[model samples]
Target: MQRQFFRYNAKSFPKCYRELATSSSIFLIFTAAIAGCTNSSLATKQQPATTQLFSPQTHLASQPPRCQTAQLSVSKVSTNAGAGNVAVIYAFTNKGSSPCNLYGYPGFALLDSKDRPLKGVKVIRSQGTYFSKQQSPRQVTLAPNGQASFEIAYNQVRDVGQSCPTSEKIQITPPNAYHHFTLPEQINPCTGQVRVTSVQPGIIQ
Candidate 1:
């Protein structure tokens, strides 16, 4: 009777074993999906921290002086007949070891024998390749031990037989971003007794 009972259970065991095997496979697939999502979240959290470490910093220095010295010499002068303009040429050399940036329009004031400011003296307006844009005035960047020339036009004539002393001063303004230097007043020595003659046109040669 016991052997007959064992044989009856063994014949139905195949169906029960199939149900157990299917359930085990579904459980394993669900566990793998959960693990993949967990790893993806970890990677996203670390990305921002890595980017912050390599970001650049923002900092700036101040501007330097425009011209190193107060001394400037007049290299050439001429008159324009059509426009009634006087073209003045100036040569500047870097006496120091550093470079400089020139700014502002050149102005001239005629002086009498006593160095008094003479009115109505025209410093002709220059309309040439050298005229700087109103927004960004003429700026010459001189290298270490470098030299540059500046041309300016004025409306004033060199009055004939009139003994007048002429001098020029350059004004430098700092850049908009930073302020490192001051635009101090620089005065050139008087070129004594410049006699005005007939207005002519041509190069200073």
Candidate 2:
């Protein structure tokens, strides 16, 4: 009798109602699948992208190239003495056809009469000393055939000591540059300190 009752109810139900129930179940399943797919897509987008690493040399190589050493010319313009110090002005001229930038203090080294690198002394960037007031470094742009200047200051032999270091050649490397040029001029570096100024636009007076 229970089986007969169940069969009778199933048969009594409208065919459309049965079909609707089946469709509803299918729709619910389809909706859940769509929602799950959407969530997966969102998670993919939220994930962090893969990053690439680089070394200092690699990073610098990736940047826009700066002025090269071959595109510049270095020369000495003047030398002066006052108090217990000597000031020497060196000029940097851009020989390249395009404009280039110069920044920071130039790297310098003293060379002896034999054109050998001087020892026990290194070039130091200075905020003006007794010889010259402190001058801040600034970016100097040079057009083709344009020029910039920098000064070096050191103490005299008498002020430093009888055994002061003497240099007949000055080697100069532009700021952030590797190649250097030499100035075959007589210079006596005192024991106090050697001061180097940043590149300046124009001829040093």
Candidate 3:
């Protein structure tokens, strides 16, 4: 004789057990949804940074206006020479009502009496010379009617016959300025080279 076991049936399961299984399925789906939303939020935070285009006008707008060529007037204040070298100090006065600054060196060229540039003449920017003290390039502020100065040195030795080349006039373009001005001067350079200093507080002595 054999003994038998009981048969399985879903309808015979407890009511609380069925309700608990359905609740677990719903909880899993809700957790998955919350995880997806968190991942999306993190991805948004990891996006690339924003980029901006370079703007010259916007950059310049934040700075003070440059010293205009028209607002400056240059005058030779003193002159000295030694060892076949000559140096002259020029003062630049601010004619405008507003204050401004001069930076770096001035572009200059020796010109003949006929208003033409001389040949082989070169201008080199320098900090100092034997007759002048060395000065670094810096912002030289000028108040209304205030002044700054610079130094120009050149050789006056013999070149071809009696002297090198000479000029009675020079064209000067101030640093950071577009327009140029002319000045009457007497210069005799045998080496065809000129060394100039940056604009400073006062005339070099």
TM-score of each: 0.39, 0.66, 0.71
Each candidate: RMSD to true structure? 11.4, 7.2, 6.8
Encode model 1's per-residue lDDT on 77-194: one tens digit a residue.
3323234334444444555666665554444345444445544344333334222222224455656655554454433333566543344333221222122222222222223322
TM-score-superior candidate, 1 or 3: 3
For candidate 3, the lDDT comes to: 0.86
TM-score of 3: 0.71
lDDT of 2 at 69: 83
Tens digits of per-residue lDDT for model 3, 143-187: 899888888999887855665778989888889899988999878
Number of the top-ranking candidate, with TM-score as the measure: 3
Assess the local accuracy of residue 37 in candidate 2 as a C-alpha lDDT between 0 and 100: 99
Ranking by lDDT: 3, 2, 1
Itemize residue pairs with steric clashes in candidate 1. Answer: 122-156, 123-154, 123-155, 124-153, 124-154, 124-155, 125-153, 158-196
User: Taking the tens digit of each residue's C-alpha lDDT, what string does model 2 give over 1-205?
Assistant: 3554434465578999989988999999999999999999999889787888866997665444466789999988888887777888888899998888888888988888787978767678885655556678877888889999888888775643367777788788999999988878666675746788888888766
lDDT of each: 0.42, 0.80, 0.86
What stretches of model 2 exceed 4 Å from their correct place? 1-3, 6-65, 157-161
- In model 3, which regions exceed 4 Å deviation? 1-63
